[model samples]
Target: MQLKELSGQSGVSAASIKYYLREGLLPAGETVHATRAQYSAKHVERLELIQALRRIVGLNIEQIRGLLKMADDGAPRLTVLAAVQRVVLHLDTAAASGDRPTPAADAVVRLRNWPDYPSDARNALNVHLELMESLHIPVTRELLDTYSKAMDDVAGLDIAVTTAPDSVDQLILTAAVGMHMHSQLLLKLLALAQASHAIRRYEEDA
Candidate 1:
């Protein structure tokens, strides 16, 4: 496909595509002539993934480049997925900002036995603790234990689906894009369940 066709098919502007090509975010299309170039299905797929990472996952060009490199280099899927998650979920910034994990966070990690798991999970828990502190919300160990139980329940499905993808690239995309999307869906369902419970409890009083 030509640049115009690629742009149309990918739903990204030709100008942006050219910019990505120049920035090394997208691979260069095959040059057919001095000016003309041809793109393939791979380009289209790559563009779609790039767009998702940019618009949906909110990854900057550098992070996307790293993600693409990790995908192409056949790095360990779990590590690559963790790197992608850190970028997409802003975990790296959170981990960097905090000097150390809060005692509450560390206790939760020990209670949950996540020390053997990937660092991403532990880091995210620390970020949550930081948020609680910043908001002046006192979280009890008991409450954290309850939350951990719920998180573990959700994480079981999250890990299962995220690891099911056959390719490293797909897993990265899934962890970055798909998992957050699914998280939102689950939150919405939880909200609906809460609403239903509230209505059931309050309906008799009304």
Candidate 2:
């Protein structure tokens, strides 16, 4: 497919596609002539991914660039997916807020030292905290703790599944589908497990 064909199929303007090509978000197409280039299905898929990351996921160009680099380098799709998930979640929540919120000094301090959280993740979290504050949602220490614990539990399970050698593809597929289709159930199951463990601990203490 030519640039115009790709543009037509992707719903992205030809100029924007060229811009993405220049920015290294999309791979260079095959040089057919001095002025003509031919794109393939891979290019089309990548362009759609870029568009989705930008327009739907609300990632800035630089952030999308980082993600594209990671994807191109054959980094585990889980890592990219996790980062994208965090960004999309924050974007959706923030979009619902009419006003920006201020981050608590303590929350900022805690977030600053959070290990393995890239700058983009921190930015997204900051935006989410601000949105919560604007909505009068308390940025209490307990709230942060709860969020951290929930993420930790999910990440632990995800890591376990992804590391399993025998069914890696199946695991990734399950995660991709389950995270979208059964997210509520997954959350509920985690909450139930936590509640059960808490009850057991209380009973033992009593």
Q: Indicate which candidate wins on lDDT.
A: 1
lDDT of 2: 0.64
Tens-place lDDT per residue, model 2, 75-111, is: 6765756655554444334343323323553464465
3-111: candidate 1 lDDT, tens digit per residue:
9999999899999999999988788989999999999988888888888888887778898998898888778876787887777666776655454557887777787
Report each candidate's C-alpha RMSD, comma-separated, in the order given: 3.1, 9.8
Candidate 1 segments whose C-alpha is farther than 4 A from its true place: 95-99, 117-121, 130-138, 200-206
C-alpha TM-score for every candidate: 0.77, 0.47
Q: Could you tell me the TM-score of candidate 2?
A: 0.47
